[model samples]
Every structure is written in C-alpha cells, then in structure tokens.
Target: MDVAARLIGSVRLPGAAALVTGAPHGAPAGRLALRRGDRLEVYGVAELFADAPRPEAAFPAPWPGWDRGVDAVAPDGSFAVFSGQRAVRAVAADGRALWEHRHGCWGPVVGHPHTGDEQEVCGGLEHGSVHVPADGRSVWAHVVDADGPEHWVVLDARDGRETARFPLEDSAASGSHQFSLPGGGTVLLCVGMGQDGVLLYGADGAGTPDGTGPSGVRDLGEDLDRILLDVHPDRPVYLTVEHSCDDLRVHAPDGTVLAGRDAAELGEDRCWDYAAGFADADTVVAVAENGEDDGPGHWLLDAHSLAVLGPVAYPHPVTGSLRALGDGTWLTHDRATDTLSRWRRAGA
Candidate 1:
C-alpha cells in the first residue's frame, strides 16, 4: 500500500489542548476538538443535533482556578481536567459534575477513571470521596478525612453525590489508559513504578468472575506506558501504542500478542489511533509520530514483521488523543495547526 501523508486541514483554535473523538466515519463527528484561549471552548459534537451549539455537555466549571489545563478526555466521554497539585476533575458527559478528586497512588500510579455516560464519571476524590447512588440519589458517601485508599465510588448524576465506594485492592495510578468498557467496566494501564502491569475492573455481573460477585478483575502482567483501549462492545481487547523501548504489542484477553513491533526509539504511549489504528483485531498499524514529513514517516511497516507497506508523511505532529472508529480514517491531533485531523489508511 502506498502511504500518502499530509495535513487534512489546519484548525484555527488557540488556548489549551483539545480532547478529540472522531465521528462514526472517522470524520469529526461527536464534537469538534477545540482550544479556548486557555480554557476549553465549547465545540461539542452534539451541536449538530441541536441548535446554536449547545453541547449536550459542557464543563460548567472553569478549568481549576490553579491548574495548567485539561490534561485528558476520558474514553467514557468525560474530561480528565487538571486541578493543581495532582487533582483532577472527572466531569460527566450529561453536562453534570460527576466527581472532583485527586490521585491516590504514592509515586507513579495511573489513576484516571472515565465516565461511561452523561450520567456518572469516576476518579480519586479528595477529602476521601465515596457515596453509592440508589434510585437516582447518592445512597451515602464516606467522606475520606484524608487521602488514603479512596475507593472508586459510584455516584448520583444530578448533584455530584456519592452512592457506594469500595477500596481498590491495588493503588496503581491512572495513566493515559484510564477508560470505561462498554459495560461500565474500568480499565487501567497500571504502570506502578515498582510493580507495574495492566489491570481491568468490570461491574460485578452474572457472567463475571464468581469471587468478585458483580465486579470483574484481571491482571495482564507487563509494564506499559501508553495503550488505546477499544471498549466498543464490537471490539474489546485493545490496540496500543506500547512504550517500552519503542515497541508496540497488541494483545488479546488471553494475553496473546496478536501483533508486535519494536521501535529503535520510543514514541508517545498516548498516540493517535484514528480509525482505531491500522491494526484491527487482526491487523496492526504500528507508526511513530516523529517522522520527517507526515506521520507514517518514510515507511509504513507491518506491525508484526516491520514489512514496508510504503512511506507516510504528515504536515504536522499528532497530539492530544487518538480514537479508532474502525472505518478507514483516524481522529488525530495535528499540533502544528492544532486541528482535529484524520488519516485515511484502509481505502484512501
């Protein structure tokens, strides 16, 4: 395949970075990723359905009074906003306040939890936040006087109230891989500085592990830097931007490396997976962002064999986040123009 690389378009927005998710067809759908003079400007994808650009959602609160900017957008459509000193605001998607919390891991533990819907979002809350919701209200929140082992609490959507909280068996931080699965399951790419690996938590349900009752927990032992989790019920597992010595490893539930690649140099763990990346459940599109021209660089390699499909170049560097829609194009961040860009690799 001959790879052609170029900037699809240069968006004109300034301020901070953007949290971009592509539309159904790899086109900018749900909402356009925008930067707002420093705060987040409202350019939600829901505007197309409504009038005058009212996002079915918005971060009603301004960026934390004392913070750099919103660090990330959740796989559950929530925003992982920075709130000074390791604090994060897990804003809900329904234009509601899900929860405002801080990191719990001691040193390097990825702890970002995503809001799966417009209803609830999750994260480590300060003041020891915890409350389980019932019948649309927070059942109870055990206020953590201090920031120790705060549980991942389920909350009520209406008023940032808690319902129930459970302590995390482990204290791995939320890395770039914090996301919710199709069924309210939380996935974390645990990079514990000393004892790191990948761990998954799912709502305790009928088919889940018997011991967990309603919650499902599994450990995929391996230190990972960046990973792209595909929670779409249609596509589970994940297509990752592996960050150990510049290697990409695609795995299955059984820990099988479906596809693998090694990079002489390391790339961003949190990279663009536009079109859910070149590697589908069966194919792997392993790419590096620091190429001369377009992103694909001088050669598009077979994720497993490093075989050359062709060379690809980009007008700018890919930034922010990436989404795999499974079509042919990918939702990417072009840092040069700061536009939510796309890359067509399948049939382009």
Candidate 2:
C-alpha cells in the first residue's frame, strides 16, 4: 500500500541542525523547537505552516562555542540547560548562569583535570545528554562521574541542586540521549556503546526539593540495542528503533513492548532507520531503506498496533528523517538546501 504526502509548507532555517518537542502531554501542543547553531528557535505549529515568520523567540546556548554535550531549552524558552564536560549549567537568555552543578568530566582522558577550556575537551570522543521536563522546574542529565561511572541525575531547575541520582551499570558509553516522558518528572536515557550495543534506562522522580523522595532508576533490560525515539502525544508510550535497524517498537513508560514491526516485513534487505516518530495520536511516520533503493523509503504505521499501513509517497524527493511535530504533521530536513519542510497526509 502507498499513502500520498502533501507538502503543507517549508521554512529555511540556516544552520538548523536538530528538532525537539515537549513532553507528549505537555501544554501548548502546537509549539515546536529547533536547534539552530548555538541557539534554539521556537515556533508555533500554525506559524510554520502559514506565515513562516521569524521564530517566536530564540535562546542562546549556555555553552556558545562548544557543541560536544547535548542541551535542552525550557518548555517556555526562558532558559536552557547545558550538559557540559564538567558540569551542567542552566543559563538564561541574557547569558546569566542561573545555576551550575559540577560533575566528572565526560572526556575519555583519565584525571585530565578540566581547566574550563572548551577547546581542551572539544577533542573528547564521548559525551552525554540533558533534558527539561514539561513543568520546566527540573533538569535531568546523564553524565560521567569522577569515579568513572555514568549516572542519571535530577537537578532543581531553580538552584541547580542535585535532587536525586543513580549510577548506571553500563560503562562503555560512547554517548547517550535523554527523553522526558509525558507526565513531566519521568525520563528515559539511551546510551550508545560504539559497536557493542545500546543501553536504556528510566529515571523516576517528582523533582523533590529535599533531595529525597520516590526517586530511582529502572534498567529497561540488558544486552539491549533499542534507541528511544519519540513518545505518544496523548499517552505515556514511546517509540524506539532497534540499533541495527532490525525493527521498530512502541513501548510503555515502564519499558514494556506494546507493539513491534520487523524490517523483514517492509521488504527484502530493508532496515528501519534510527529515526521514527508519532505524527499524531494514531499514526507514525517511519523510514525504511532497502538495499535496492536509491534513498530512504518513508512509511506510515498504525500507532497503536505498529502495523504497516503503507509507504509514504512524497510529491517530491525528500532526504533524511522526519521529525513529528505532534500536531498532526511531520517535518523533513534537506541538508543540501538547509530547508525544513513540513508535510501531512494528502486530503487529511
């Protein structure tokens, strides 16, 4: 089966490298954020498809020049949290350091003694990720410690105080990604270990003030290669693509596999790409490229049952993955032209 895609609209955001959405259940559902160079550009879903005017607002990155570690802008775009080599800092738009929580260096060098020089640690091959929940009152980070162990930590957004932490079991992490669940306080972390495999962990905490509460980490499983992608906009479920592109699965907040589809079901020698997302409550847009294809193939899946609905036939050729805006539309990035195009099912 083949489903046609219509070009709803497109915007040219020079240097825009990434896309992000708030918790599936977060408020202001039509808003989306983009990482453009050293800043973040926030725009409303309606604006992107209609006016394509200047962004609603832009927030400067906490670490302006260093792009090694991952960062997340607040839901309201008031502040941004930077997961740096030695510390996680929350900074405002005016470049004010609201707070900083120091931790071990994420660099590979042992006892390297980071001297606060971005260039010194820019060569490191490893890094971690940070995220802000929907409430924007706390920050979740996955970082390495001085004792050579990675830990998932929750920090108070107001003061940068460590509220809770748990050391991870996997140590051969090349890097990781952090995702915030729908309700706001829960989070999921996916760690990549080069060619070995990937690790997934969930951290639950209400962002308590006393640094003590119902906070802990749950290991999704061992010898896992799943990469957590996007969460359901109206549910606590999330999407994941197998590291080797073998399959795509929808998972509950507690890490239970709700539904899955193998790459073999797509075509001969076909594999799911590392990216897939919930276009809306009942639909998922995924990419699966087979050996015979000249480029990646886009497909639509039943969000609940993970059943292959059909391939997504675009009006014109598109490249790379689609980033779901969670408002019944998805976006594709064209690196050759530095353009971000939004699309939807034709006649939808």
Candidate 3:
C-alpha cells in the first residue's frame, strides 16, 4: 500500500506537555482527546479539526483515580462518563454529575485457604470502564467488585439507572475494555489481565448469559499479554488483538485466529505498539516505533487476507498510535509539537 498522510488541521492544547491517550474511540464527536498535566482537559474531534477548534470542556485530573485510564464522551459532546476507583459518574459538559454508581473497593478481602482469619488485599481500579454507545442513550460500565463477582452493566445515559447487567466469567479480572459495533446493537467487552478473554453482550436492554441475546465468552488464553484493539462495527464477529506489541492477530469471537502477523515477521526492529486496530472492515493498521528513531510509523494489512500492505508515510513524526475515524481518515498526535492532526489517503 502506497499511503500518504496530509495534515488537514492541528491544535495546541493547554498543558505543561501532551499525554496522548491513544486515539479516542466510541465517541460520535470525532476522536476524543484527553490531555493531562496541571489538570485534565477533554476535547472533541470537532474541537481539534474544525476551522476554529476549541476545547469542549475541562475537568480536574486524577478524578479520584481513573481506572485503566479509560473513559468515554457522548457523541454529541453533551456528557462524559468517568470511572474512578470505586465509582463511575456521568458528568455533563458543565461538570455536573448526571448520575453516579459506586461499587465495592477494587481490592477484595480474602480469607486464608486454611485459616479463617481475614487477609487484607488491594488491587486498585484497573479493570473498570465506562463506554457510551453510538446511540448516545446508554452507558456501558464494567464494574469490578472486590467483594463479589464483577459485572458489565448498561445504564441509561440520562439517568444512570441500571437497565441490564451481565456477570463476567472472570471475577478476578484486573481491567476491562469495551468496543461498540458500528450500527449500535452489540458491544464486545474484553476483560483484561487474569481472564484475558472477550465477552459478547447485546446492546439492547436484555443482557443475558445463557447463550441468549447473542452473548458468549471466549478465552484468549492464559499468561499472554493481549489487548482487544477494535471490533468491526459492521462485522462484530471479527476483532483485533494486540499481544504485547509482539503481533496483531485478527480473530473470530470464538478465539480463533483467522490471520495475523508478528512484528518480527514484518521486518520491524521492535514489537508493534498497542496503538493498532481495524482501520475499516477490510483494512487493519498497525504502528511501531520507527527504527530510525523518527517517532512512530504504521503498517497496513489486508484485514481478510492478513497480508502486509506496506508502511504508511506520515509527514510528521507520530508520537501516539493511529486511531481510525471509521470514515477514510485517521488521527495522530504529535507530542513534540503538542498538536493533533488528521490524515487521510493521499488524495482521499
């Protein structure tokens, strides 16, 4: 693939420095950008790409400890969902809490296998997340309960009421990530760490686990550093997984690897970055730190064939991974210049 990135626009944010938190996904308002320094600020895709881009809103950093550094903003930029150590809150642009739900401490108390004495433990909030589906009517929260089983709860975005819940098979999961399908009927939850697996849940109000409502679980395996990158909105049956930068595997929902390529096989100097995913239904984009120390570079692969298409040429060094916009464009952040740029096919 002979690809070139044209810098359509750029925006400098307010902060001591830029902390690129990957490419914002699941938001309708373009790509969401979160910058942290003295404080935390959230910017919508329009705010970064519009002729006159401005911050949609700003909030205090370390918002009681954001688990997994994962949060979601509504597509219209009306509200944002934030997951803290023990609670998830849907806050309006004005910083008003629309609703808040709290769970038990991330760390659960344990009793010795033989002794009855209680053992103190702590895990923090690593597997918790809050995601807003495309419809913008509901928020998907992966709440981890140290005292009991963890669950994937669907809450009304307007009122934060639990509409449905699905118990996760992996109760000791350290973190969880969610990917919403394009048309907005199903959402895939990838429970991270201990479980290292994926769960299919119905986006509708019914969150069933008895093989109903198109819900099921697939274990990727144990002791493998894997992260769920993206699920084809059009084809939820297909998804991408990044194994600790070692390789990118495109798999079925049943943990079957359809096609994959390791970084070494791609002739790269190091592992691929975690910043890779399905650019579209037919194309997958992966990035690696440039061997020449010229920042990060990307690779294009045929999604179905898993054939390497070649590298994508960027005009500037990409400090972060490439995030697909689902259209024909992708977003890249330059930390050196503190700017966010959108790129497309050379002529597209």
The most accurate candidate by lDDT is 2
Give me the overall lDDT of model 1: 0.38
lDDT for each candidate structure? 0.38, 0.76, 0.61
For model 2, what is the C-alpha lDDT against the true structure?
0.76
Model 2 residue runs over 4 Å out of place are 20-29, 48-52, 113-120, 213-216
TM-score head-to-head 1 vs 2, winner: 2
Off by over 4 Å in 3: 15-26, 29-46, 50-52, 57-69, 107-127, 146-149, 169-171, 194-225, 252-258, 268-270, 280-282, 289-296, 316-320
For all candidates, the clash counts are: 39, 0, 4
Give one digit per residue, the lDDT tens place, for model 2 in 1-348: 789999878777664436522122122346666566776566676675554466776666666666666677787778777777778888787778898888887767766665666434545668887887777777778888887888888788889888877778665778777777777656778888879888888767574545763366777755567887887888888999888989999988778889999999987899998768989999999888887647888899999999999999888887577778666788888878877788898878
Candidate 1 vs candidate 3: the TM-score winner is 3
Q: Tell me the tens digit of each residue's lDDT in model 1 across 84-159.
A: 2233344544444456654432222245443433222233322221112112222122222134453444433334
Query: In model 3, what lDDT does residue 348 have?
Result: 58
Among residues 3 or more apart in sequence or in different chains, the pairs in candidate 3 whose N, CA or C atoms overlap within 3 Å are 28-75, 127-174, 127-175, 182-233
> What local lDDT score does residue 91 receive in model 3, on the 0 to 100 scale?
73
Candidate 1 lDDT score at position 319? 37
Per-residue lDDT value at 33 in model 1:
35
